[model samples]
Structures are given as C-alpha cells and as structure tokens.
Target: MSHYYDEHDLSRFGDMGRNAPDLWDKFNDWYQATFQEGSLTGREKALIALGVAHALQCPYCIDAWSQECLEKGSNLDQMTEAVHIAAAIRGGAALVHGVQMRKRNAQLSM
Candidate 1:
C-alpha cells in the first residue's frame, strides 16, 4: 500500500542539507554527539530513542530505532519497557492538562 510516509524516504532525511549546508552540518554534528556512548551505553541510548520514537509517533524513527536497539544489544523486553515508560509519561502529561479544564470549569461555575 502506498502511504503518505514512504519507507524509502527515510533514507532521504538528509536531503534537506542540499539546500542549507550549515544548519544541516550543525544538526548532524549534534546528532552524532548525542548518540555517542557516554554516561549511558549505546544500547541504553538506543532503547531510550525507541521509547521517544514511539512517544513522538514517528514511523521512521520507530523502524530505525527498533533495528538499532537490536544491533546495540538491547532485547525485546528492554525495548518494550522503554515504550511503556514513554507511554506512562505521555499519559501523565495528558492527564495533567486536565487541571486546566478543571480550573476553567470552576471559574465558570463561580
């Protein structure tokens, strides 16, 4: 099926650099540094990326990080838990926004 987001297009993510090289170079440098093995192991970082990918609902990132997680040595269980953590944080953020609704309702009632 032809979807709006083509899987092949993921490979072209850097194509924007053709138009603006400086911004692209800065972004690429940041990305490379961010993924380096630092305080967190590469596997741990991949799992975190997988979780954020799900939270952001980016198909390309999900696909890429799923493979990266495996290649970095994180197992299914670890990745699954990472996704759950993202879900919990996302759900909590949504729930917290309800406080605004509650405050507005109280003002209207008064």
Candidate 2:
C-alpha cells in the first residue's frame, strides 16, 4: 500500500509537524545560503550528510544521503569508509557505557 505525503502532510515518521514549514523553510534557506557556495561544495556536504545520517540511524535519511553522496561523486570506497566511521563511533559509545553499568552494579551491594 502506498500513501502520499507532501510538505503539508506532516506525518510523524521522523521530520513532521514538529517544525513549522515557515521555520523549516527559513532554516533550509539559511543553510543553502551559508553552505551552498564559496566553500564546502555540495559534494563535500553530501558526504558529511551521509556520515551524519549513519550516526543518526535514520534509514530514510541514510537512503537519501547515500544517493546524494554517490551523485556528488563520492566513490564506493569513500561511502563505505564513512559508514565504518559511524559504526566505530556507535560501537565505542556502547562500549564506553559499560563502565557506568558496571559501576552501578558494583554499588548495588552497598
């Protein structure tokens, strides 16, 4: 089954009515104005977006960013490297929290 959603649809899949279009539009406009020229080309930003999407664990965003990254000339190896970086960060985050869990367990006896 397929449902249609436009900017006005505002379904809460992820980025929905949480932000007003007026505000979102302004933010997006500013982003374009700030990063779409002079420095940090669209291709560079696409790779960054891909890395961020991986970190955020958003499948939809990941799909979009990966496509954009490829279109923007990021090779397969670069894309895979970005994903690996995200994986390492996520794993390190989980592993680092083990210290807190162990500490809490140790203190429970006291």
TM-score computed on alpha carbons, candidate 1: 0.92
Clashing pairs for predicted structure model 1, backbone only: none
lDDT of 2 by residue, 1-110 (tens): 26553433323443642568777777767866864745788887787778878999776678778888888888999998888888898899999999999999999976
Per-model TM values vs. the true structure: 0.92, 0.69
Candidate with maximal lDDT: 1
Give RMSD (Å) of candidate 2 vs. truth.
4.9
**Model 2 lDDT vs. the true structure?**
0.77
Number of clashing residue pairs in every model? 0, 0
Summarize candidate 1's per-residue lDDT along 9-95 as a digit string, tens digits.
899998989999999999999999999999999888999999999999999999999999999888899999999999999999999
